[model samples]
Target: MAASLAAKVHYLDITGEIDVFEHASSLDGEARQANILLCPGVGFDVIPTDCLALALKQALPDATSLCLGFESHSLKSPGTAKTTVEGIGQGTKIRREATIRTEPMGVRARRIDFGQGERLAVAFPWGDVSTAYKTTGIPSITVYVAVTSSFRLAMLAANLLAPILRLPLVRRRMLASAGTAVGPDTEARREAPTYLWGEVRNESGEVRTARIRTANGYDVTIHGALAVLRHIMEMRDFDPGFTTPALLCGASLIEELPGSGKIKIR
Candidate 1:
């Protein structure tokens, strides 16, 4: 599938100086010591986060990882359910799952402890971890979202809708509707590709953000998952809070996937 896409995509190589800016932000020393949090979206979206975490562990051997599971707005609800970890032998291993509740920004998250050197996996919904950065003290966070081929349009809608969605009444109704609407079959109906956008912060108060899209076909989670790992691998220094995947990783990043084009800088 990847080989097929590699032949079709026309990607442009970003050249010259990549301008990265410094943002004034400080990482809590304690947060730097916290475990990694992986929020793969409900049901099908969960697969990509799991794949990304596994790929990340391979690239950063010393890193400990976990997948998030949620109670309030997940497909597998009301009881403990098992989820498969792809890319492993026979794909049979199951991570012990945990539940997270949906709440307003700045709300304290329930404490979750991890043993030394242990890689854990949990599943949770998007935006649920807004406060995890403070409560859990995680130094970095990578969020994956699937969007239509028209990524710019999707992103615009999200940005425009964010404030409206934040309204308590609206958020509650939306969550309620989504809980009843999404399911495992959701992936089958989704034809768009996946993208990864995340933030990395240092103790000295600098934040770097990145957005990368898959070079593979629509609905292919692994492509976006691998793109996330590549972004983490290539981000050695702080960048302009807004930047493209091509600017950071170069055109070769998409050389293997055909329909995938150069990163669009808006």
Candidate 2:
């Protein structure tokens, strides 16, 4: 982002890193002065959920709490595996009253219906816990993903060994193994689909629920990045400085992706 600002070029990345967003936000003044856009999370990490959050907010302008969940059949890429390793031992994060807070990973669990049957979902430190609040003024936010029984058991074990997992040696070993992983094959990527779910509630108890199904993660990343690039190039005027995918391109951007199904809301 710094280099992009220096060169007076727009910057975009498919990162779910909270620090990256914070750093880019800190440069908002510089980016605005240079008339450059610094947009991030233009992919699977936050695009669908971010848009859903905003849509829910639009449905209930006084919304105060939000919950987002997803179920992805896509295999983890090498980069994603490494990023997971990097987050080892880090507890789950959620937004409370518009502030980021950390808690035990498996502490929160609920049933989520991702436009299909209900499944067990566990809270995690997903990117939207940070980005969603920025997209919508909804204060309380939690992001979750569908989990199998074994995965939930692993989360319990992770909570028990959190301190040990944070050790440099342990993390390095895990990272090494993650680096060796080969991601999904062409057929696997083509067949796998990603499902997203979101709900928002206001003080009056009104609720809005929505869901979206998209192509595999890697495909979404590729197409979303290009779509954002195209939108940026064809724009006459746009928000300068740090922004998010839905904020920059509108919530309809997700629906516009060639490989995504229309968002379903209730």
Candidate 3:
């Protein structure tokens, strides 16, 4: 039905342990922005002096901390499955393997200009799955992709990743640490006020930011795991080089609704 008809939900998959990246942003009144806070709901036993956010800085050198997540659901069923995600593919930087779900409708993204009530200039993809953790609480990561012309956000991501992905050396450098990254060393906490537009808020309470370098141009800001996830997912979904990521090359997750993804903390 979706193939023959217009699919309500579009799915974009990514591969290889994608790196966490970030960019700086300026918000406009209604252009669509997201806010993220640390999940007070989650806790880990290791309780290292450093938190997941700190680790991301070391692993994902070129990422900013942003709070926009994607929803991935089957075009057939838009009722279930949704997730609060960061980026895609064993996103070790943020400490999630497969932890979040996806939503049917694309996120209301930032407008090209702030005030006019224009539609989304960027279309972030929906996160597909959520990875669970055992000893260290429930850490996870979600992925998204924007392929179709209808999704403008996907296009912007492509623009950014271009220079980054253009050189094989950089891509190989990040992808080298696929599954075995421990995280970043403890560092002094920086106090930065998150600059945002729209409904975006910092759910985690403490606001932290970093300067990231990517295959494409890079920006530094206060968006954490979620925003980095979005950037990578969109890049693969829209780019020609990594059109079909390595992860989806073999098996794929079942079609579901938003928020359905889970990482059982048992």
Candidate 4:
């Protein structure tokens, strides 16, 4: 499994600093040295952006300083996906108006260094777990999935399709069909309220798992963020690589969910 994941790790470099963020302030000496910024992926629904921002503000007032966002371009679409990279200081708004290009990984931005103590944040919307692990040297990372009966099946399918998607011919064929839309009401697109399936790992190592469901319509991504925040707040240590939330915080995170949310841990 480790070997398989290692195969997907692509190292690419960005040349000529493209102003990806609109209002990024120059980091002071202290902020550059010790603070950690949460760089979440694109697509709002897949990640609990607002909740995470709020949680970081309330919980780790000192360490947490910046939130990073990205603009994702579709393989088929002509225009770029405009995104805002919001910073905490002076409400700094760094916006990426045009798509930033990078080699090897196609449209996705490559691993960026934010000086010392920077973590490449991971969550549900961020699908490429191996890439994040390789890019960010941070040992413990949290990944969340919205687990429903169908979504679990989707994950199984994704696991199976992961390798197949790497095949040159198959990837080429799929990219050609990228813009083709499936019917919304199709079984594959069915909607259901989902609980969070959280996993923490490092490299190929699997640390722990947590399943959380909330009645207040909070998806697992929020808890995923909370789990990550709690993990950072506790100042716990673990093997450096990809890791799950439970591995860092244990079953207590599962117990902290609001109302009658179903909680399970392993």
- Most TM-score-accurate candidate: 2
lDDT of 1 by residue, 1-266 (tens): 12212343212121111011101012222122331212122122332222333333333333322323211122332111211111111111111122223322211122222211122222223331332222223433323222223532433344445566557776566555445543334454243343433333344544332233442222233354466455555555533222223333433444344334333221
- Using lDDT as the measure, the top candidate is 2
Looking at model 2, report the run of 10 residues with the lowest lDDT sum.
17-26
lDDT for predicted candidate 3 compared with the true structure: 0.23
lDDT of 3 by residue, 110-189 (tens): 43222222333333332112111211122333222222346444444544555664466754554454433332222211
Give one digit per residue, the lDDT tens place, for model 2 in 142-174.
999999978888888898998999999999899
Give a tens-digit lDDT track for model 4, residues 1-266: 12223443211111111131111112222222333322222122223222232233233333212222222111212111111101001111121212222121111222322221222322222322222222322333223322234534444354445556557676555544543533222232223233344333333443333344332222333454555565565674544332323333443443454332444434
TM-score of each: 0.25, 0.96, 0.22, 0.27
The parts of candidate 2 lying over 4 Å away from their true place are none
Ranking 1 against 4 by TM-score, winner: 4
Model 1 earns a TM-score of 0.25
Model 4 lDDT at residue 134: 23
Candidate 3 runs further than 4 Å off? 1-99, 108-150, 153-204, 216-266
Candidates, ranked, TM-score: 2, 4, 1, 3
